[model samples]
Target: MPDIVFKSVPFSKEDVTLALESGVDGIITDAAHVDGVRTLALCDVWAEADMPSVALGSKAEEESIAARIASGERLVLAQGWEIIPVENLLAQPAVAGKLAVEAASLTEARLAAGILECGVPTIVVLPEALSSLKSIVAELKLSQGALSLGKATVTEVRTVGLGHRVCVDTLTLMERGQGMLIGNSSAFTFLVHAETEHNEYVAARPFRINAGGVHAYAVMPGDKTCYVGELRSGDEVLIVNADGRTSLATVGRIKTEVRPMLMISAEMETPDGVRSGAVFLQNAETIRLVRSDGTPVSVVALRPGDEIVCRADVAGRHFGMRVQENIREI
Candidate 1:
């Protein structure tokens, strides 16, 4: 993940507090208040004089910036930085994790983080950018990158006996096709639809996803997964849309209840072969899986050969993070 640092040259305690609260990784302050800022919080503090912002006006400056970063110098890019110069610098070799860009607004910060697909290693938010610090961090840091999703055909749907299922109640309201990715394995998962569709029997609870059995793996931010049973209030869960766009939301509450469950199995053609995956979900009228057209289908009505959206990958996860070592879930 790219880092966000706020520049507090004139030094406002309130601004520093806001930056820290907004989840910035570091703060660049002047020398006089180094001790004073340290007293406020245990965050990274750098003297403004030591690490100054570098302006990129010509081709030579790009080489100088790259050489400085390559030779073990940490640089914070000056405000008003352009796209071409950064793109040129990113094209050079060995430039990851050593460069930072000072952004005057959220727009620049977002653009800086997405340059050349990999983006800058760090972002420096100026004082003028403090107003939107929360938004900046939420997009650049909290919102994890893209998730690949595709359609899969359902092969089996069977009723499992009563079991504990998790209902993730997030603070964000979801749309029709927005929900969490959950399954027995992190590699092969289903997009369990959110409770956004209104029915005559029940009103929409757009913030909740009655995810799956307690033992299921729920995909999380940072390309990680967490067991549904272990989810708690305040933990972050990845919210995925049918289009594979992702957003971050805090789990306001976790509702675990004993409910009749259904075991759903699906398969999709992959480059390797026909890949299969399964998920255990509550067998209720409201619980749904997304269709390829971004529509929601109830689990009770889902039939064999019915195409629904799923995510498939190589089957190995070590403590939620993807790894190459061989492993299986059945």
Candidate 2:
């Protein structure tokens, strides 16, 4: 996540209050205001006098600032900064994650974020533009993190009788090979492909995923997971692709109904050894899981020895949050 610092110069108590409530990472204000800001919010408050600043008026000055950043100075605000100088500094291997730019408006913030495609890891926003702080922060944080997906070979598939299955309808239209991560255990999850590919019998539903049984866990943003039964409309879910890239999608609807379910189990080869996991999903022709080649394989057609993509983790979760505990789920 990128750091969002509120510049509280010409400090207004109301603006500081707004910044603190908006979930900004820190506040940069005058030394006299530091104590007052601290009294209101428990966040990093840096006195303006303590921060080093550089005027990017010349190439030499920009290079000097980059050198200082490379030598381990983590926070330096760039004034009169432009795309080229920021790009140049960012291109340097040593200054990759140490730069912060002052952004005057939402447009400037967007430019700062999209520079070099990775953007600066921090941005100091002027106090007057605090009204746009939330949206700006959201735009910066929406850049999805990547996941490491591995191959899992189908070991078993069997009818599991009738059970309640969940169909998640997201507001975002998903591609043919994208969907949510779901499984019985949080440690191992299957990339249950979206119902976007048309079949001879059923029309394509590009926004829906017949995820799994009600008790199954679906991956959420920030490395969390929630039971499919717990999800509701307006909730945010993580939509992942075959290549492990992810983005946030809002849940528009959740349909839970009795359906014939199938228990699908697979084994994955890991550095430690082979690990096995399973998910019970609707036993329908349209329900599918993602294959390694970025194609959707129908659950009805899945057979032993077929390879698919899955994610595994060692941490256990409680109430969708990661927790340290010796826990197991079948």
RMSD per candidate (Å) reads: 4.5, 9.3
The list of candidate 2 runs beyond 4 A from truth reads 1-139
- Model 2: per-residue Cα lDDT at residue 57: 72
CA deviation > 4 Å runs, candidate 1: 5-75, 80-99, 105-107, 115-121, 127-135
* Best candidate (score: lDDT): 1
TM-score of 2: 0.65
lDDT for each residue of candidate 2 in 236-296, tens digit (9 for 90 to 100): 8999889988888899999999999999999899898888899999999999998889899
Q: Give the Cα-based TM-score of candidate 1 against the true structure.
A: 0.75
lDDT of each: 0.90, 0.87
**Pairs clashing within candidate 2:** none
